[model samples]
Target: MARIRVQNLVKAWGDFRAVDDIDFETNDGEFVALLGPSGCGKSTTLRLIAGLDQATSGQIFIDDRDVTQVAAAKRNLALVFQSYALFPHLSVADNITFGLSVRGVPRAERERRLEKTASLLGVTALLGRKPSQLSGGQQQRVALGRALISEAPVCLLDEPLSNLDAKLRAEMRNEIRTLQQRLGITMVFVTHDQTEAMSMADRVILMKSGKVEQCGTPAELYENPASTFVAGFIGTPPMNLVAAAPKDGRLAVAAAASSDLVLGVRPEHIEFAGEGQEAVVAGSEYFGADTVVACRIGEQKLMVRVPGRPGLGTGAQVRLAWAPSNEHAFDARSGLRKSA
Candidate 1:
């Protein structure tokens, strides 16, 4: 579709800035996710891009054309909200064709668009079904179909999958990705779910308090976080962070019960050893494929994912160790990475 460029954007409410001056770009056919905690300005950024709300300052460019002041209708973007927003009284076909019909697209063109979209979304038989008759996941598909029928290069989704159950959400993630790639639309997704962002995005925009904490490929943020906030936010069984000092020729993890430095290792990257950093078992979680072992070394704890290690049950004594390279060094006071 079209490339979208956001430059030095700012959005404010009275004296409080909801979205700080930020810069980013989404390439043609790219699927970028704006991820953050609640009230972090991710949704505000989406509204700004969709022209649902105006920016307080800065510019927005779609296909290199300035449209910061464009009306939402003029921008021609397809936006799906967290709620499906489908018309309960309208049949699936009517819902999908509403956009075209409103724009005065002739019957022939509308039918053509509807046919292509229904087939793409596998809702051909669903045409006569009203929103109430369809399942939640199906309703979401129709919502997306409505957008797809627009054939706009840019698509904005505001947590379109949030309303579904876990299974439906999982299924829809793949469906959305497949459809996005098939249509080759430049899509901007806004969600507070880190797993969704990490699983589906081409690049992630991690936001905090209206400012960008970091923007990078999932691997980049997981491996080399720019700040302590990111370090704690990006991983499953997140990186271990404890206060530590690089002294006495070795670092002590202070949270590891007053050890020297905070030790950062992935849950899957840690190993149990007798001679390694001494720790007591704080907790354990067992999954069939693997078991997660949480070891408390001094006052701090680290989680390690191990396979076939049921022998080391909860409260068991063990030594936690990781490859030197697996360890991350952070400033004792700042908690920001000292070295990647």
Candidate 2:
């Protein structure tokens, strides 16, 4: 296993910068995920680390060695691409052993490694089949097996499960996490999906506009977001942000109709209170186990999540309340969390 460090990394295309001076480090055997929406530089950062794309400026380190200028082939890291990048004509065993073959590894050693990787990925029976003959999940396993057979200290994955169905994606998330833990390889996974990053990564490096937004464990970003963008990006229904002022222990419109404060409360945090902020129910969605009600406080909208069906109807008058500790305050001008 190896610790990967990216210091002052920058990637640019002409005048447009894709990654801007981003810095972070992954511990040995740690799973770090780069997460953000499309065009947010997560993929660019990953490619830079893989040596697939040259950075405009910065340095990359694998363990104690400076590999900023190292060739991709010499980096000694396994990479699993988004498309699986398998040769359709080759059987699973051949695909997995291609790296070994290229390196002229002994035939017996290659076979031994192949056996272990196949067993670990549960693709022992599919060794003779081509990628085209395999299911999506099976193909993903073969792709992973290819990387595992390399026995590299670092493993990098680029949206490896995005092509799978929702159920398969969830399954693969667990499988990949388990495989990383079992192998103790330092991993860097890039994904636009927040759920995948939160569920699979030991730590998440949230990015925006080619810059580092926040880097922390999943719980840290969810419970204590550093900025309004993160507050709106991390949750299922997202946190409800309303422009309001603290009034008589409740949030309400300011008498002056001007305030730089925004109150953030997660949909799950807002509860039905008899004495709270008055709002009109604009819409409600039933999700079998829970219901999300969209409430309108004047022109602003907020969502309230409740267990089961609340039978809330449109235009119904309701008061939304939440615990003091549950409320997050942000400055409207800067869109950053306000210190209490």
Candidate 3:
């Protein structure tokens, strides 16, 4: 296992800077995820670590060794691609052992490592099968088994689960997390999906415009976002940001004007307050155990995720309230939080 450190990393293509100066480090055996939307420079960062793309400037250190100029094949690191790059004619056993054979490892040692990796991945029985005969999830396990047999101290996964169905993706995520912890290999996963990053990462590196927006554990980014962009980007149904004004000591949301500030609240944070319903119900979506209520306060829209919610029709009067602790205040100019 190895700790991965990326310091002052920058990648640029001509005048277009793909990755700005970004600094992040992961402890040995820590599963850190690089998360961002498309064109946010996550993939570029991964390629830099994998030695596939040269950085414009900066360094990457694995196990305290500076490997900024190391070739991908010589880095002693494993990078699994989304394509599941399995050879067509090779059986699972052959595919897993190919790297070892190419590296000139003895047959006995290769078999031993192959057996261990197969057992770790629960793919021992599938060794005789070809890629065409296996399901997507099974094929993914074979890919993982191949990487594991390499015994690389660091593993980089580039949207490895993107090819699987939703249900299988969820199942495999936990499985991968278990395997990662059990084997104690430091892992860095790259994905645009927030749910994947939130579920699998020990810590998340949130990026935007080739820059580090925020980096923290999933709960930190979700509960105390540093900016309106982070708050809006990190949540499901996202956060409800309204143009707000300070009314006396109470915060007032406007439909007609922006009086005081822009106050943000998550959908799950807003509670339904009844015919004292000061806001209008613009829409409601039923989801068996809970409903997502879309309330309009002035000209702004705020969604509230309420469980076992009472039926409220469109134009139904309702009031919205968020706990003081759940409220996030941001600076209008910088778009950064007033306080963490």
lDDT scores of the candidates, listed in order: 0.86, 0.92, 0.88
What lDDT tens digits, residue by residue, belong to model 1 across residues 210-287? 999899998888888877778788877777777675655555566434543455667887888667767888878888
Model 2: CA > 4 A from native: 248-258
lDDT of 3 by residue, 63-145 (tens): 88999999898888998888889988999999999999999999999999999999888999999999999999999999998
Candidate 2 lDDT tens digits, 1-340: 8999999999999999999999999999999999999999999999999999998999999997999999998999999999999998899999999999999999999999999999999999999998999999999999999988999999999999899999999999999999999999999999999989999999999999999999999999999999999999899998877787987765664334347988889999889899977889999999999999998887788889999999888999998788888888889898899877
Off by over 4 Å in 1: 247-250, 255-262
How much is the lDDT of residue 156 in candidate 2?
Answer: 96
lDDT of 2: 0.92
Query: Against the true structure, whose TM-score is highest?
Result: 2
**lDDT preference between candidates 1 and 2, better one:** 2
TM-score result, candidate 2: 0.97
Candidate 1 at 32: error in angstroms?
0.5
Clashes of each: 18, 0, 6
Identify the superior model by TM-score, candidate 1 or candidate 3. 3
- Per-candidate TM equals 0.94, 0.97, 0.95
Candidate 1 clashes: the total is 18
